[model samples]
Target: MLKIQEIRELIKLIDKSSINEFKYENDGSKIVLKKNAGTAVSYQTEEVPVQPVVNQAPPAIESAPAAEPVKASPEVQQESKAAEEDSSLHKVVSPMVGTFYAASSPDDGPFVKPGDQVSKDSIVCIIEAMKLFNEIESEVNGEIVKVLVENGQLVEYGQPLFLVKAE
Candidate 1:
């Protein structure tokens, strides 16, 4: 929210200057001061425009300055890493409709995890079609982002197996 004095100051500036518009931004909040060649000064934000109390004249109103782009933080990077370490890194998709399997046998461990680095042709998992198990290969070299299908789940041809961020 903009303070009343701040609004008045902006109006004063607009009144004195020849510039038709002026704006300032801080974090999410913004204040825009606008005036025509000869008109009343008005302030506006992303929400409602703040109309100045008309002691005498109507003020000019214009939109606030454009918002700056948000920057990614370290926490976002760590989260992305954790997601890559998770099973979502498998970039290879299913070539045919079948059931997804982690290993060749029931007693064996999973073929891959989130953090496991994979390359093109890496056997990430298995897709069983018509009682035949086919080894699924990784098509991209990258860290995993997410696993779309679970083990033993029925998978369709061309289904996404994992999301991978390229190295």
Candidate 2:
């Protein structure tokens, strides 16, 4: 059986590589990994007997024909420009998958809000996992531009929680 850390590393490796699909079988275990444009990574595992199969060359993957680019309308162009501007801001991302908390307790005020200035060590929020509350700190010195998450939201690892304009 593969360990959790090993599976994580495999996913990272597949994400960075050109291979879109990978399959492996050993003993009574089988694993497959696949990726799509919008989907980061998807995998499946099953406990089945390994079957003996002849080694065959992989099928050639043909590239799709490219189509001419369509020009965007004026309104669409304006919205695209605005999105580009927002991309310049730094993001405070979740370090682990957990339930996000905006304050220490239900009655307490939030640790930080939009327009607040924070240093690298400032504790911006808390994340609860397995009944443990972890204080999450900002890794950058910046002024908070926006809060991306609401209180008590389920946050995924690496998901952006706040946007900031760095000093």
Candidate 3:
């Protein structure tokens, strides 16, 4: 446990420093404090996970096409040929780091699904980031060919979220 004096000294150090967030844990007590420039500070405490750590390297993946049977459906084959000829049906990527919400709320239906048509500025879904819910708009006028992420999955910036076939 930290003494009151120690906590006060930590606050003082934070005020004098330029760091935005600080977290510390000791003797079963944990504290998280954040200071935003020109914004009020926030404080919270939560228990930390105690688990054994393992450092294992991930396997590398090949980028080229697989050397197996090149079987494709008639529609998929035509689409692939057309895709090679065109450049519009590429990808729509996420613009921020957040949980990908396919619907506005859990009980609500998905905003867009495979085979759904969309227009420019159409709200496809919501992405919750930093405690803020942001509506994601479709930048391309197209039909959704595929949804790349499951609902509520963590997504990174620039990650491909959908395959949009230009209309």
lDDT agreement with native, every candidate = 0.70, 0.77, 0.74
Better lDDT candidate (1, 2): 2
Candidate 3 Cα lDDT to native: 0.74
Span of ten consecutive residues with least summed lDDT in model 1: 37-46
Q: What is the C-alpha RMSD of each candidate to the true structure, in Å?
A: 19.0, 13.7, 12.4
lDDT, candidate 2, residue 150? 73
Q: Candidate 3, residues 1-167: lDDT per residue as tens digits?
A: 77778877888888789886677876666666566543232233445453322332334676986334234468865664554444667577889988889998899999999899999999998888889999999998989987777787777899767778987
Deviation from native of the Cα of residue 65 in model 2, angstroms: 42
RMSD of 3: 12.4
Off by over 4 Å in 1: 1-90
Please give the lDDT score for candidate 1: 0.70
Q: Score candidate 3 by TM-score against the native.
A: 0.50
lDDT of 2 at 131: 98
**Candidate 2's C-alpha lDDT?**
0.77
- Candidates 1 and 2 compared: the better one by TM-score is 2
What lDDT score goes with residue 10 in model 3?
86
